[model samples]
Target: MTGPALRPVSGVPQRWITVLGSGPLPGRPELVADADLVLGGRRNLDAAGVPADRALVLGPLAPALDAVAALAPASAPAPAPAPAPAPSDGASATTARVLVLASGDPGFFGIVRALAERFGPDALDVRPGTSSVAEAFARIGLPWDDAVVVSAHGRDPRTAFNACRSQRKTAVLTAPGAGPAEIGAALLAVPGIERRLVVATDLGTATERVEELTPAQAAARDWPGVQVVLCLAVADGAGGADGAVGPMRALAGPTEGPDGWALSEEAFEHRDSMVTKAEVRALALARLGPRLGTLVWDVGAGSGSVAIECARLGAAVVAVERTEDGVRRIRANARAHGVDVGVVHGSAPGALDGLPAPDAVFIGGGGADLPAVVTACAERALRTVVVTLAALDRVPDVRAALLAAGFTAEGVQLQAARLAPLPGGVSRLAAINPVFVLWGTRTAPGSIPVDSSATTAPSGDS
Candidate 1:
C-alpha cells in the first residue's frame, strides 16, 4: 500500500516545521507527538517515536521538499462548512506541524536552509543543537573559536583540503565518500605537510568515538560513519596546558591575510638584489589575482618575493627556482612571513610537468628560454599569465607565445622614480630601471599547441 501524501488538514491556518538538532530529543517532545506529518532519517524517526502513519522517511531532498511545499498556508484547502473557531493567536484548532530531524545543528549546513528557502523563515521553528565541528573540537579539549570550519558534504572536497593545508586549525564536515580516509589520503600527497587528524564519529551517541591520528594512520583505516575531522597543525607546544588543549581565542578562524602586499625589498632575503622590486611586484600581483582556494605558480622565483606575497594573500603558492640557494631563500622567506609556499628547485617548461594546474601564473625570470617557459605556463594556466622582463627586445616573442596559447595579450613599460635623500636633507627623484610588464588573459579555456623549442636568452634573474 502507498503511504499518505502530505496534505493540509481543513481548518488549519498555520504550520510549524521544527528541526530537531543533534543529540537526544530536547524539551519539545510534543512537537513530534503532535506533528501531523514528520520527516527525518530512519534513526531520527525511530528515536522520536513518530507514528508510521505520520512519518515520512527523508531520502532524496527534492521529493521531500516538494511534499512540504504542498502544505503551505496558501495551498491549504478551504475550511470545512463547520470549521473550528480560530484561536486568539489566529491558528485554527488543528495546525499542521512538521518535525524535521537532522544531525547536529540543522541551521548549520543542514536541512534548515532548504526548508527556509522553500517555505520562508516565518514558516520554520528551528531548534539548533551543537554543531559537529564544535563537538569535535570539544572532544579534544581545544578551543574552536580560531578553527576554520568547512563542509565537504555533497560539494567539492578540495576546498576543505586546501583550508586544512593553509590554516593551522580546520574542521571538515564529512560525507560518505569524502570522509576521514579520503581527507587523510589527500593530505599525505602534500610535501612537508605536518598535520594531525581528529576523527569524531557517532557524536552524542552511546557508541561515540573520537580518536587522533596522523594522516598516514587515518588514511590506512576505513572510517565508517565519521561525522567530522579536525585537522590540526603539528608544532612544538601547540596544544595547550600540558600539551593537550590550547588557549582560548577571542577571535574565530584563521587570522586575516596581511594588511598590505608588495612589501619592500628589505622584507625578503635575496642575493645581490635579485628580487622583483616592490613597484613591479604590486602590478604583477594585481594581474595574478591570488586568493583562497586558488593555486598560483611563480616561475623563476629568484627570491620568492612574489610567491610569499601571494601566499600571504591566501592563495596556495608554488615557487620554482633553479638555483639551490634561490630555493632556500624562497622557503626561508615564506617562513619569515608566516605563510606556506611550496618551493620547487628546478627550471621552467620542464619542471612545470607533474605539478597541479594553476589558476594563474607569474613568470618573473626565464632567461633565453622566456618564450618557451611562457608557452608552457600558458598552456596549463586556467585563467591568466603575467610576465616581467627588463629587456624590451623579448616583448614581441612573449606576446606571440601568449597569443599562440589562446590568450589576449597586452603590455606596458613601467618606469618609476622614488624620492631619494640628497645632501642637506634635500630629496631627488631616483629613476628605477624600466620593466616590460606583459599579461595575457585566456580568451577561452582549453590548451593550444606551442613550439617549446624556441629559446631566448640564457636563464637569469630579471
Candidate 2:
C-alpha cells in the first residue's frame, strides 16, 4: 500500500468491446475515452457527436458483424486516428477499444443476439435501455403481463397473426415489410376476430408518435420505420385514458369447464346412440391432450361428442362430417354445450386438406377407408393421432399405418358395463360393445419400439 496508491481494478478497461443502447447517450466517460472504434447507425453516432474517422456506419448486419469480428481479437490493430487529434496523455493507446451502438435494450430481440452469436456472451458488456414494447405499453397505461409478445421482425408474420387470432391481448414488434399496415390487413381477413390496433413509432425519441386506429384505418395509411403494434379485442377491451382500447377479455377464450369430462350420452342431443361412449372418450381425450392454443381435428365427427369434449377442454375444434344430418347434429350439440366448433360438411382425407394442421386428431368413423383416413391424420398431426374401431380385422392395418408414419403406436380395447336394475331390485351388469382404440405419437428416428405388443390382436372382447 505504501509502495503505490491502491485503486479498484476497473472492469471497463479490461472489456475490449461494448455494445451500447441508443437513448440519450449514457455518461460512461471511461468507456468512451478508451473506444478506438465506434460502430453504429449514422444518426446514432451523429447524435452522440462521435467523429467520422472513429465511427463506422452500420449497413447490412452480416457485413457489419464481419467487421466487428475482424476487430474482436486481442492482437487486432486499433482504428485509424480522427484527422490529426493527438492521443490522450497517460492512456493506453496501444489497446483496441470497439463500441457497438444499438437501440433500446440490445438484449431484447435486438443486436445483442447477433453479437452474442459471433463473440459469445462473456466477450462483451451490454448496457441495456428500455425495450420498445415496454415503452409502447407505458404510453397507453396498460399492463403487458397478460399480453403475448411476438416479433414480426425478419420473420414470417403468420405466427403473430395466429396469436392475435387466438389471444385477446398481443403485441407485435414490427420490421420493414411486416408493420402495422400488414398486420391490420391480415386481422381484417380473419372471420370473427375484431382487433383495435395501437401503433407506437420511434418511442423515446423526439419524433415519437402514438396512434390508435381501427384495422381498416391502419391498413389505409402508410406506416414506416421501427414500430410496435398492440392488437386488442374490441368486445373485451376497456377504454384507456388515451382513447385507446384496453384489454377486456380475461386471457383469451372460455375459462370454465363442465364439472367432469367424458360426459354421459344424454348431455348431448344425438340421434340414437351414435356418440362415442363415455369410458372410450376418457381414454381418447387423454391421448389427444387438447389444450389452449392448439387445434384438434375430429375426422368423421358423427354426433360430434368427441369434438365437443375437445372444444370444452380449450382446444380449437374442426368436426368433419359428410351426411347433412350428422353435420346438423354436430352443430346443434356444439351450440347446446356452448362451445365453438368449425363444422366442415365433407369427407375426411379431403376435408382435412383446407383445415389447419392439428396438434391431435380423433378418428371416430372412417367406414371402409379407415386405414386411408388414419394415414392422412397421422401425416398431418403434430402431437398425437387416435382412432377407434369396431372391426377386429382392421386393427393390424391401422396399427401398421401409424407405425409407417413414424409413430410409437399403442392400442387398448375398452369394454364397459353399467349397473342394470333387475325385477327383484338386484343390480346386474349390462355389457356395452367393446371398441378398440389405437393411438400414435411421433417418435424420433432410430428409437426403439415403445409398444410393439400393442400391435398384436386382442385375446377376446370380455
Candidate 3:
C-alpha cells in the first residue's frame, strides 16, 4: 500500500553560482536555461530567456543581495562515489543553481566587489568581459595604459571632472545625471581648457555608438544612455612633425607632480624681489594643501609663483594680478613650468567675483583692499584660506575677517637667513625680511571655535 520507497535525502545540497559578464552568455546558454535562480538586469534576463519564476531583476542592490544570501544552501551534501565532471547544465532538482549576469568586467568598478563581499570570493565563478573604459579607448585607437580612469556611477562626478581637467588623458564611467552633458558643461566652465570629449553609448551591444566632439559640442547635446566618456587633452606636439604617436611612456596615469616645490625666486620671472620668498612660500603651500581636482585662487598673484606652483602640484589655478606686467609674468612663468594657469587681468576683491568658488585661496598682495579681499576669499573658499603679509599691522584685520567667516585662524612669522659666501671661504647667514603667514581652515559643521590664541606665536619666537 505504501508509495515507492523514498530515497534518503541528506543535508541541503551546496549551490554553484556563476557570475557572467555582459552580453550573451558566451556559449553557456544552458547555465541560464537550467538555473533554479537567475539574477540580472531586465535586458539580460529577457535576452537569456530565463523563466519568470526563476528570474530576479536587479534593482536596489540590498534586496537582490538579500535574496541571494537567503537562497544559499544551508550545508554541504555528500560527495559523489567516484570522480565526475562538475554539473554544466544545472544542479539536481533538490539543489539550487544560481546564474548572475553583470555588465563589462564586473571586477573593474562593477558588481563583483559587492558579490565577493557579500558571498565571499570562493563562492563565485566569474567570467568577465571588456570594460566600457577599455572599449571607449579602443574606439579611438589610443593606448589607455597612460590614462586616468574614474567612476562617476552613483557617486559624485567632481573627482572624475577634476581628473579630466588635470590629466592629459582620463576615462570616466558615466551614470544617469552625470553623463556626457554634465561632464561637457563642467569642462566648458574652465576658461581656455583645451580638451576633446569622446562619448560612447551602449557599449558591447548591437546598438553601440561612439562619437568624438569638443566639450562645447558635447555640452550642447543631450546624450542618452551614455556608458563611458573619454576626456583627452589636445595634442601638444608630443608627436613628431608628421603627427605620429609619441614615444611610448614608461609610466601610467597623469604626469607626476613637480620634483620640487616652493621653488627659488630665481626660477620665476618677477619684478625686483616682489615674489613671495621661497621660505614663506614653503609654509604657504603647506597651508594651502593644493592637489588634483581642486581650484586655487592666487589673489594679487605677483609673478604667479604661487599660482604656477599650485598648478605644478595638480590644482587648477587662477592667478589674479592687477598690473599688466604681472599678468604677463604669470602667464610666462606658467608656460615656463609647462602647466596651465588661468590669469585674470584685474585687481582682487573685484576680480575674485567672477572666478569659480575656490577650494583654497592664497592672498599674497591685497594692499589697501586686503581686508575686503580676505572677506571675499573667505566667503567663497571651500576649505582653507592662506594670506602672507609683510606688514604686521594687517595681521589683526586678516584674523578678524577669517573669524567672522567661521574659520579657525592661525599665524606664523617666518624669518630665514640664507647662506651668503664670505670673503674667507666661509658662509654667513644673511637675514631675509620677516613675513607673517596666516592660514584659516573652514570649521566643520556644528563646530566653530574662534581660537583667540591663534595670534600667539607657536613656541619659538624672536
Clashing pairs in 1: 240-245, 240-246, 367-457, 368-456, 368-457, 368-458
Each prediction's whole-model lDDT (CA): 0.76, 0.72, 0.76
- Return the candidate ranking by TM-score, descending: 3, 1, 2
- Give per-candidate clash totals: 6, 1, 0
lDDT of 3 by residue, 137-253 (tens): 888787887777877655545666766766667788876555788788877666655788889987767898998888889888998767789888775654311111356878866
How far in Å is the alpha carbon of 200 misplaced in model 1?
1.6
- Report the lDDT tens digits of candidate 2 across residue range 1-462: 358543322232334567777665444445555677787767667777777777777655676676777777664233333322324542222333777766777787677777778776655667766777778889888877667677655554555665554455678877555578877776665333457888997777788899889888988989865468988766424543222344465563234456889999998877778889999999999999887556778989999999899878767677888889998898889768866677788887887775656778999964788999999988888778999989889999999999999988899889999999999889999999999999999895322122332222110000
Candidate 3 achieves a global lDDT of 0.76
Between candidates 2 and 3, the one scoring higher on lDDT is 3
TM-score for predicted model 2 compared with the true structure: 0.62
True-structure RMSD, every candidate: 10.7, 12.1, 10.9
Better of 1 and 2 by TM-score: 1
What TM-score fits each model?
0.82, 0.62, 0.83
Model 2 lDDT-worst window of ten: 453-462
Total backbone clashes of candidate 1, pairs 3 or more residues apart or in separate chains: 6
